[model samples]
Target: MLSATPRTSLGREKHRGSTDRNDLYQVLDTGLVCHLGVVADGHPMVVPTCYGRVGDTLYLHGSTGARSLRAADGAEVCVTVTHLDGLVLARSIFSHSVNYRSAVVYGRARLVTDPDERMDGLRALSEQLVPGQWDYARRPSRKELAATAVLALSLEEASVKIRQGAPEDEDEDYALPVWAGVLPLVTAWGKPEPDPVLPEGIETPVHILRRE
Candidate 1:
């Protein structure tokens, strides 16, 4: 359940619209890393980490060294995921901006206490990086899960902002003899690197080898 909010400047031009819970989860599922923000000692603490979304929940795994997580328990926190599609190059630097998609979730994060949900959340997190990874990789052991801290946040309160296409330069600037076009950006996976101690007969899985 997402409430109606004022549209962002860029959101009005394209994808900036009311982002319901479903759109946010889809964005979370599409990306691997997210930045979690919280207040620590009255100062903002933002940490970049891996996250995943399942149903109406967003889960982030962090280390004991993380201050944001410690201070964020039962307190309101903001988790965001952003994907930059390209650089909007304008005739003038003043009108230059970026083409990107971003989602921000606001809610109180709680430590996942249920054992079954914790493992299931971790599987969702693993599957985020690679769709079939949860089944392919070894599941977390009891001791390992105990050592990890997973924070869960509801997806009900969130926002999405996006911008697309060319820059908004002055009409007169069109005549200026300068390059005015988008500098494209894209994310891609590299060739698989096998472990030095990997078993001899274990070739890279087709999912990893054929990843785009």
Candidate 2:
């Protein structure tokens, strides 16, 4: 179950809210990018970032010099991931909406300083981006590790919302002679584009070529 705290609870659209913890995890797992919100120098900042989840923890990494990650250390932050599924066209403008799945997590990000934990966090982030990339590519070196910073946040407080299917038009509006249907959106991977400088004989690995 999700927390009922004021910050995490769904106040306005309670009908779309979900209490199943698995729903939160599912959204996080399927999402490719997340927006990290933090307060920096008394000003709010939101940065687009990649993240990884390990059990109950979410890991975010960036260059040590990134201001957003620096300010996130030991500070409360909000992380959100959303997937646009389709556009709902209704007979009335008021009933028009979008189908989507979204998750929001709130917690104080703990700066990961320990070398072992830091490496683990980085591994998670790498694997999240490319399932087999961690094992396929060279691991981070000590010098490279020093230039990176990782933040760990618990997935204890979160909210999940999902909206799907056709629009809910009013009874009177349904009788109108208006075309109404869903415009479904689908995401797919295109053929791989090889790097210009890559060696001619080198072929793309099956793991990457077949990645979904």
Per-residue alpha-carbon lDDT of model 2 for 1-212, expressed as tens digits?
88878988888878889999999999999888999999998999999999999899999999999999989999999999999999999999999999999999999999998888888889889888888999998988889998999999999999999999989999999889999989999999889899899988999999999999
Model 2 misplaced regions, further than 4 Å: none
Give the lDDT of residue 101 in candidate 2: 94
- Using TM-score as the measure, the top candidate is 2
RMSD to native, candidate 1: 2.6
In candidate 2, list every pair of residues with a backbone clash. none
Mind giving the per-residue lDDT tens digits that candidate 1 earns over 112-168?
999888887888888787878788878877778778888899876777766789888
Residues forming the 10-long window of minimal summed lDDT in candidate 2: 4-13
- lDDT: worst 10-residue window of model 1: 5-14
**Whole-model alpha-carbon lDDT for candidate 2:** 0.93
RMSD of 2: 0.9
Residue 71 error, candidate 2, Å:
1.1
Query: Candidate 1 has which clashing residue pairs, if any?
Result: 11-16
Predictions in order: lDDT:
0.80, 0.93
